[model samples]
Structure formats: C-alpha cells, structure tokens
Target chain A: MIIVKIGGNILDNPERLQAFLLDFAQMPGPKVLVHGGGKIASALGQKLGITPKMVEGRRITDAETLDLVTMVYGGLVNKNVVAKLQALGCNAIGLTGADANIIPAQKRPVREIDYGFAGDVAGPESINADALEFMLEAGLTPVFAPLTHDTKGSMLNTNADTIASVLATALAHKYKVQLVYSFEKKGVLQDAADDASVIPYITAGKYKLLKETGVVNAGMVPKLDNAFAALQQGVAQVLICEGEALPSINTRQYSGTTLSLN
Target chain B: MIIVKIGGNILDNPERLQAFLLDFAQMPGPKVLVHGGGKIASALGQKLGITPKMVEGRRITDAETLDLVTMVYGGLVNKNVVAKLQALGCNAIGLTGADANIIPAQKRPVREIDYGFAGDVAGPESINADALEFMLEAGLTPVFAPLTHDTKGSMLNTNADTIASVLATALAHKYKVQLVYSFEKKGVLQDAADDASVIPYITAGKYKLLKETGVVNAGMVPKLDNAFAALQQGVAQVLICEGEALPSINTRQYSGTTLSLN
Candidate 1:
C-alpha cells in the first residue's frame, strides 16, 4: 500500500495539481492521499478580517481559524480532489478523523504556546486501522483532510504530514506501506536554488550531517522527522519527491530522495 | 431503520438543533440523518460578494454558488454535525455523493433557466444501497450533505429532501424504513398562521383536499411529493413533524402528521 501526502505547493497550483492527480489516479494498488491546506484558507481568512496567529512558523489555530481550515481543507480542497479522482476512475472517498471515527485525537494541552484547537495524535492506537483496511480491501481510495476530531464535539487542525506518518505506521502491520511526501520540489536539495541539487538518498548519518551543515533547515526538519518515524515504525520505505514524480516512485524511475534508518 | 431529514430552520438554530440531535441521539435503531444547507452558505456567499440567483424560490446554482455551498454544506455543517454526534456516543460519518461514490448523479439539463451546477437524481439506481447498508450494519450513522457528484468530476447542488427520500427507498429492501421530515413546524398545519392547527393524519385523499383548499401551499409541495414518493417506492411510513419530536415518532407517541396512501 502507498500513502502519499501532497503539500500545499502542489495544491495551490492548478496545473501541477491536475498533473499530479492524474498520475495518482492511474497508479496501481491500494493507496491513500493526505492533503494540506493551501493559501486559499489564509486568503479567505484575510477577507474575513481574521488575522492568523503564528508561532515559530506554526499556525496557532484559534476557533475562527479552525472553522476556516475545516471549510477550505475538508470541504473545498478535499472534495475537489475526490471528484477529480472519481472522474479519473479512482473510487475515492474523502474523510476527516471524525468520520467513521477513523483517527480520533485529543486536543493539544496548553504548553508554552497554546495552540488553540490543535490536536495531537495519541498514538497508532488512536487510528481505526481496521476500518481503513476494510475500505482499502473494498477498493476505496481515501483522500484525507488535515483535520481531526476529539471524539467529543470539536474539530481540530492537525498537520497533514503527521496524519500521513501515523496512518502509514498504523497500517504497516497489515500492508507493506510506502510513505511518500510530495511537494513542488524534486527532492531535498543541497542547494535551495538549484533544482538539480536533489539528494537522491539519505541515511541517518547523512541526514545528521546535512542538518548540522544547515543544508536541511526550517520546514524540512519536522517533515523528515515524520518520514524517519514512519520508517522506524514498520513502514517499508519513505520517499520525498515532486508531486509529478509520485507514480514513478514505485517503479524505481522517480528522481526523489529515499530515506532509510541505516 | 429510520431516516430523518432535518430542514434549514432547525439547523440554523443551535439550541433547537442541539435539542433535536439529543432526541435523535437517544433514539434506538439503525438510522441516518440528511441535512439541508441553512442560511450560512448564503451569508457566506454574500460576504464573498457572490449574489445568489433564485427562480421561483429555488436556488439556481452557478459555479460560484456551487463552490460556496460545497464548502459550507459539505464541509462546515457536515463536520460539525458528525463531531457532535461523536460526542453524543453515536458513531457518525459525514458524506457527499462523491464519497465512496455512494450517490452518483447527473448534472441537471438546461431548461428554461440553466441550473448550472444543480443535479437531478436519475433514480434509486443512483444510490449505492449496499455501501449505506454496510455502514449502517457496521454501526455507523451517516450524515449526508446536500450535495451529489457527477461521476465525471463535478459536484452538484442536490436537494436534501430528495436525498433522504431516495436513500430510504433504496435501503427499504434491506430494512423496515421510516422516513421523517423534520422542520420548524410541529406538523403539516391546516392554518399556516396557527401553530396549534397541525393536522394529525393525512391520507392521499386528505392531502389532495388539503392541496385543493390551499392549506398546503407552495414550499411544502416538493417535501410532500418526496414523502409520498418514498411511500410509493416501498418505504414503510412517512412523517412530517417538529425536529424535536423525531425520537417520539417510532414509539407511536409523537405529535406529528402521519401520511398514508389510505
């Protein structure tokens, strides 16, 4: 099974999204797609005169921002992806954590910075892996939004990368899962400005050296952490690639970075 | 099985919706809830500077209106309802027609006025009864949004009443189905101005007389049409009642107008 997480860069670009989804629809075997919110929500929030609160490049989801993200991520982007996949002959279903109690989480506790309405996955046990396996076995491809519910009455903004990693790890026992993170870039780059500087493969040692040298910085840290976590938690392989290169990954023809524990 | 359709008036009122949902939550049996879009979509559309086009009190959905409704109805309202149901201990899943390809529809053809993104149900065949039955058997209550999708990648604005009716009729083969339409009114009233004028029972003949006497006026015509159609299509019973009286209907203790072919 393949679990693909598409970032906002691809989602915000229509041509890129269309090309990527077309590839995704044509891919064989059971698969799931997790997507993040694009600029649409923040733009809409601005229109509503809601200023977003950010701490250390992470969004602090207030009540109003939660509603906005739910509307845009769960509603607009998720449905559109499902509809397009359906048109391309993929039987797709859109889901949030609350749906069918698929991935229930607890609201984040107030720490140094209170991230209001944000959620943290309790663990792999928090996921309804059996339900997901049922859907997959039944030939249903799930497209997930970056939202989860507390099993109480609240929807929370969650990180899509975290969702993908957790789902991959949870489902690994049942299927040989390949977790892929697809974005605009070809792969992790040694030089940010050079598209051809894509590092083809990285082991734990290489990753550490790259991080120490500051070649891998900022947003890439948490993403790589999630990838490595999935690998350690029984996921077969993890790939970081451009959205268009996703279908080629399984065939060993993709130009992307592959991560391994050793 | 009981299939309840909640109208916009009750949904727009949080206190009323909570009361109705509480009763619905406590009800016994396998059930489904279908909800219509409230004023939220229209209000949001206005905020986005998109004017709605309505002909003869029916929304004429264009592309922009379709997006707005999809976000508000399929996203915000559906998730909120599912989250609340989860809190109340009812395992609920939210769905659009595109989800799991559960309800596939065709775009409404252009007639006198083009209903751009509006959809018409082809019939019971458009419903995936087996999927619904599977979910219900698995102890999941489905909450449907007022949207359906063309298998060819377009989400259409569908009527919630029609969705409920079609679902009840399709699932009738597997379960003893009761279809309930819950709105602001206690029941179908003989006098529109009098809250106490709810007609207790209406056979086909009584409905005709009510219609001829102008007691049943414009907005209700389609609702009753759907209810009667459900009965004709093998649904066991149909009721029109206040949203709060939903739980009492199955116990033969409700104060709603019951419809029969007699």
Candidate 2:
C-alpha cells in the first residue's frame, strides 16, 4: 500500500493539484491520499474575523480555527478531491477520522500553549487498520482530511503528515507500505537557494549532520522527523518528492530523495 | 433496515437533535440516518453576500449555493451528528453520495426555471445498495448528507427526503425496510395551528381528501408524495413523526402519523 501525503501548497494551486491527482489516479495498486488544509481556511477565517495565531510554525488551533479547518479540509477540499478522483475512474471515498471512528485521538494537553482543539494520535494503535484494510480489500481508495475526532462528540485539527505516517505504520503489518511526502520542491535540497541541489539519499547520520549544519531547518525538520519516524516503525520505505513525480517513484526511478536508516 | 430522514428545523435545534439522536442510537436494528441542511447555509451565504433563491419551497441551487450547502451539510452537520452518535455508542459513519459512489445522480434538466447544480436520482438503480449493505453488515450505521454526485465530476445538491426514500426502497430487497421522516411537527396535522390535531393515520384516499380540504398544503405535499412513492416502491412501512418520537416507532405504540397506501 502507498500512503501519499500532499502538502498544502499543492492543494492551494489548482493546476498542481490536478496534475498530482492525475498521477495518483494512474498509479496501480492500493493507495491512500492524505491532504492538508491550504490558504482557503485561513482566508475564510480572516473573513470570519478569526485571525489565526501561529507559534514556531505550528498553528494554535482555537475552536473557531478548528471549525474553519473542518469546513475547508474535511468538506471542501476532501470532497473536491474525491470527485476529481471519481472523474478519473478511481473509486475514491472522502473521510475525516470521525467518519468511521477510524482514527480516534486525544485533545492535546495544555502545557505551554492551549491548543484548544488540536489532537494527537497516541500511536499506530489509534488507527483502525482492520476497517481501512477492509476498504482497501474491497477496492476503495480513501482520501483523508486532516481532521480527527476525540470519540466524545468533538472534532480536532490534526496534522496531515502525522496522519499519513501513523496510517502507514499501522498498515505496514498487513501491506508493504511505502510512505511518500509530496510537496512543491523536487526533493530535499542540499542548499537552500539551489533547486538543483537535490539530496539523492539521506541516511539517519547524514540527516543529523544536515540539521547540525543548519541545512535542514524550519518546517522541513518536523516533516523529515515524521518520515523517519514512520520508517522506524516498520514502514517499508519513505520518499520526499514533488507531487507530479509520484508515479515514477515506484518504478525505481530516482525522482526524489529516498530516506534510509543506514 | 430502517431509514430515517430528519428535517432541517429539528436539525437546527440542539435539544431536539440530541433527543432524536439518542432515540436513534438506542433503536435496536440496522438503520441509516439521512439529514437535511438547516438554515445555517443560507445564513452563512448571506454573511458571504450570496442571497439564496427559492422557488415554491425548493431551493434554487446555484453554483455558489451548492458549495455552501456541501460544506454545511456534508461537513459541519454530518460530522457533528456522527460524533454525537459515536458518543452515544452507535458506530455511525457519515457519507455523501460521492463517497463510494453510493448514489449517482444526473443534473436536473432545464425546466421552467433552471435548477443549477440540482440533481435527480434516476431511481433505485442509482443507489449502490450492495455498498450500503456491506456497511450495514459490518455493524455501521450510515449518516447521509443531502449531497450526491453526477458521476462525472460535479457534486449536486439533492433532497434528503428523496435520498431516504430511495435508499429505503433500494435496500428493501435485502432487509425489512422501514422509512421514517422526523420533523418539528408531530405528524401531518388536521389543523395547522393546533399541535394536538395530528392525524394518527392517513391512507391514499384520505390524503387526497385532506389535500382537497387544504389540511395538507404547501411544503408537505412533496413530503407526503415522497412517502407514498416509497410505499409504492416496496418499502415495508413509512412513518411521518416528530424527531423525538423516533425510538417508539418500532413498537406497537403509535407516536406519530403513519402513512398507508390503502
């Protein structure tokens, strides 16, 4: 099974999203798509006079922001992607974690920041792999929104990358899961300014050195951490690639940077 | 299998919706809940500077209105209900017609007034009874939003009553299907002003007489038409009741008006 996590930037761009979804639709075998919220939610939030608060690149998900993200991610973006996939002859079903209680989460504990409606998945056990496998076995592709439920009449804003990683790790026991993070860039770059300075392969040691040298900083750190965490948890492989390059990755083509434990 | 369609007014009321959901959760059997969009969409649309157009009680779903309803019905209301049902210990999954391609519809043809983005289900054939039965067999209660897809790419605004009637009629072959419509009123009342004037039972002939005498007029004509249509299409039973009276429906106790084809 292939678990693809598309970045918010791609979703914000219609042309890029269409291209990525086309590649995704043409890919053979069972696959799942997890998408993040884009500017739409923030824009709508602004319209509603709910200015978003961000601390160290992480969103402070207040109750209003949670509702906005739920409407945008779970409703607008998720349904649109499913509809497009259906048009492309892929049997895609849109889902929030609440849909089937597929991924029950707990509200984030208030230590420093009071993330009002943010959630954290306990572990792979939080995922309902059996139900997901049933859908896959029955030839259905699930398109997931970045939202989960507390299983207690509340919805929470969850990270799409975390959702994808946990799902891949959970399904790894049943299927040879390949986790892919698709973003705007071709791959993780060795130099911040040079797009062509794509790192072909990154081992754990090299990743540590890159971070030490300040080569990998900011948002990419958490994303890479998620990727490596998934790899550590029995996921067969992890790839950081551009959205359009997804189809070629399975064919042993060096389309993007591959993560390794070595 | 029992299919319940809850009206918008009841959905708009939290106490009534909670009471209805508790009753629905306690009902002992495989069942489905189909919900209509409340006034939230129109109110939001107004805030967004989009005025809703209605012709003879039917919403004229323009492009903007379709998006608004999709978000309100498919996202906000559906997820809320699912979460509440989960809290009540009912394993409920929310769905739009696009999910699993359960109900494929065609865009409404241009008639006297072009109903933009509105859809009409061809018949029972449009419903994917096998997929629905699969979910039911797996011990999941489906909560349907008032949305369907054109099977090409576009999502359409569909009537919740029609969706419920069609679903019940289609699944009748596999299960003893009972259709219920729960609204603010107790049932079809003989006098619109008196809440106690609810007619306990109405046959086809009596319904015609009641309509001729103007007891049932305006919005209710279509609702009764849908009920009679479902009854004629092999649904075992059809009931028009108050939302809170849902649980007692299966027992010998009559809480609301029952519709009969005789």
How would you encode candidate 1's per-residue C-alpha lDDT over A190-244 as one tens digit per residue?
Answer: 9999999999999988998999999998879989988887888899999999888
lDDT by residue for model 1 (B1-262), tens? 9999997888899998888788888888899999999999988888888899988766799898998988999899999999999889888889998998888999988878778899888988779888888888888899999899999988999999999999999998889899999878899998899988999889889888888999999889988978888888889899999887876786768898999888
- Chain B TM-score by candidate, in order shown: 0.97, 0.95
Q: How many clashing residue pairs, candidate 2?
A: 0
TM-score of each: 0.97, 0.97
Q: Could you give candidate 1's fraction of true interface contacts? A: 0.78
Count backbone clashes in candidate 1. 0
lDDT of 1 at B83: 93
Worst 10 residues of 1 chain B by lDDT: B244-253
In order, the Cα lDDT scores of the candidates are 0.90, 0.88
> In each prediction, how many residue pairs overlap at the backbone (N, C-alpha, C within less than 3 A)?
0, 0
Give model 2's DockQ, 2 decimals.
0.76
Reported per model, the fraction of native interface contacts reproduced equals: 0.78, 0.63
